[model samples]
Target: MNSFGQAVDASNLDKDVKSTTLHSVGDAAPDFSCRTTDSREFKLSAQMGRVVLLYFFSSSNPACFAQMKYLENEVFQKLRRRDDFQMIALGRGHAREELVQIGGEHRLTFPLAADPKQEIYTRYFSKYVPRIVVLRWDGSIAYQASGADYEGVLRLQEVLARELAAARTR
Candidate 1:
């Protein structure tokens, strides 16, 4: 069951969808900077003292859309007000203009970035859409998930909560 007490059907997820990620839990997250759809600069290194969530998706993938919706509705809504939390949804291989249009169409409230050349996305993973990476306050990777499945999304929420609590105590 998910946080909302709904049953998550994982059987519908594509079995072949897997993450070929280069980073692992406890590894230092790669730092990069980019301009968000809102014209704000986002630098991973600058978010050192905060828990950062990086969401990579493709605008052309329907499964990615589903995951994006979950992040926006379930994750973003609950954590947007936290000063120690930052979320960036990046369009893998998409240009800034495309991300801006997508943000407007989806009414996304969080920062939307564009990785037109896959520069940022390639640093984390070589394949897979709807990938999520959670960085600890100290710039290490705390959690990562691949595919647009509820199980992954739920796990991300759990990891984020735990990481945030741990950060608060530091």
Candidate 2:
């Protein structure tokens, strides 16, 4: 739980309480049947066996942009090459071309997608920008954040660590 007394249970908590509960955590991640820059259908549930970073943000928000920039340096690059993990950049505020450009500019090899009307964000928040909800290979919620939650940043690594450990086991 955060210092704000948010439940962070990993599943459904009252929107008023703002607590995501254990059920929410283990529940099937809300699927994204959205289009990507590659014209590919990016469905969250389809990639069930892969570790995922369900990254949400708005290009117009500076904090979101800053968080992405920081992540590009701190988290993205380090996690980029892992075969078990993948990132899907989702939001409504940017055009598909613009999002593709951002990915190209950042040398991102991951899927940069558009949810122009925010079908995905509403599944997660009533309000908030740069909300990142991470997921495990089984398609369960691992962690989430809004704005610049650097303290919560380590949540990003949960997948990679699990994947690496699995790879070593194999």
Candidate 3:
């Protein structure tokens, strides 16, 4: 069983979608810096010692919205206060103002970043909305999941808990 109490075979996630990410688990996570909706700079390389969750989404995709809702309600709410965890939701091809508006509409507490040119998104996948990538404390990719579904979210929750626990012990 996974963190959400369902039997989750992480190995069985949609195969085709799973292969979409350019970087795989254990690979070094690509580094990038972007201005967030809140006007703060988010640099992935600076977050080395903490577990990081990168969520790439499109503001116009309904499936992405569903996934974002689950993340805000289920994941972010519970982990927001943790000093060792960071979550950033990147809006692919979205302007800063648009991201700000979306964040307000969704009541998202996590940082919403703007990747208006696909500069960041293309480094991970050529196409896909609601792509999730979890990076370990050492800056390596720990997990990757795609799609807007409960199972993917649950798997992410499980991986996050495991990674956070592992980071604590190191």
Candidate 4:
């Protein structure tokens, strides 16, 4: 341990920093493959050339509903329009049946994935639930946060609207 009392454990840092000697805004997102709520598998490697938003969450979190509902309204609407981009909702916990029900109840249109073993979460490089990472067409991470921020959605909407439109043509 350091004199400042912060743990001296390098292993305690984010995976991105651990794997690579450097961190930058334009780094490619780590690849991941995991099952959706309905047991369909999603592979990040296969999603190259496509914009993907990786959202990690857990059921029973009080604030999760807000994030879910917000996506259903803001981000989902954008991502589902023509598949220029994809939003992969991954649940670190909660029953698959419950995920389906909650998703349907809210009219969430994007694909809802599940990770019983947290394999996907670990692969993506985060230490908490309710985290979000937005990736661009080339698999580079465009934005990320530890939790859902209404303002973040608004900003992303603005950026994605233009990008997705351009993507549709080319």
Clashing pairs in 1: none
Model 3 stretches astray by more than 4 angstroms: 1-19
* C-alpha lDDT score of every prediction, in listed order: 0.84, 0.67, 0.85, 0.68
Ranking by lDDT: 3, 1, 4, 2
3 or 4, greater by lDDT:
3
Better of 1 and 2 by TM-score: 1
Which portions of model 4 show Cα errors greater than 4 Å? Answer: 1-24, 162-170
Residue-wise C-alpha lDDT for candidate 3, range 34-142, written one tens digit per residue = 9888789999999988999999998666777767888888888898898889999999999999988888898888899999999999999876677899999999999
**Per-residue CA lDDT of candidate 2, range 1-39, in tens?**
532334464334335335432236556677768888989
Better of 1 and 4 by lDDT: 1
lDDT per residue as tens, model 4, 7-126: 446454345334532224478887878677667778888877677777778765646678878877777775576556788888876657777987888788778876767776776654
Candidate whose lDDT is highest = 3
C-alpha lDDT of residue 26 in model 2: 56
Among all windows of ten consecutive residues in candidate 3, which has the lowest summed lDDT? 1-10
- Please provide TM-scores, in order, for all candidate models, with all chains considered together: 0.88, 0.73, 0.88, 0.74
Q: Distance (Å) between predicted and true CA of 159, model 2?
A: 6.2
**Model 1, total clashes:** 0
Number of clashing pairs per prediction, in order: 0, 7, 0, 1
In model 2, which range of ten residues has the least summed lDDT? 13-22
TM-score of 4: 0.74
Order of models, best TM-score first: 3, 1, 4, 2
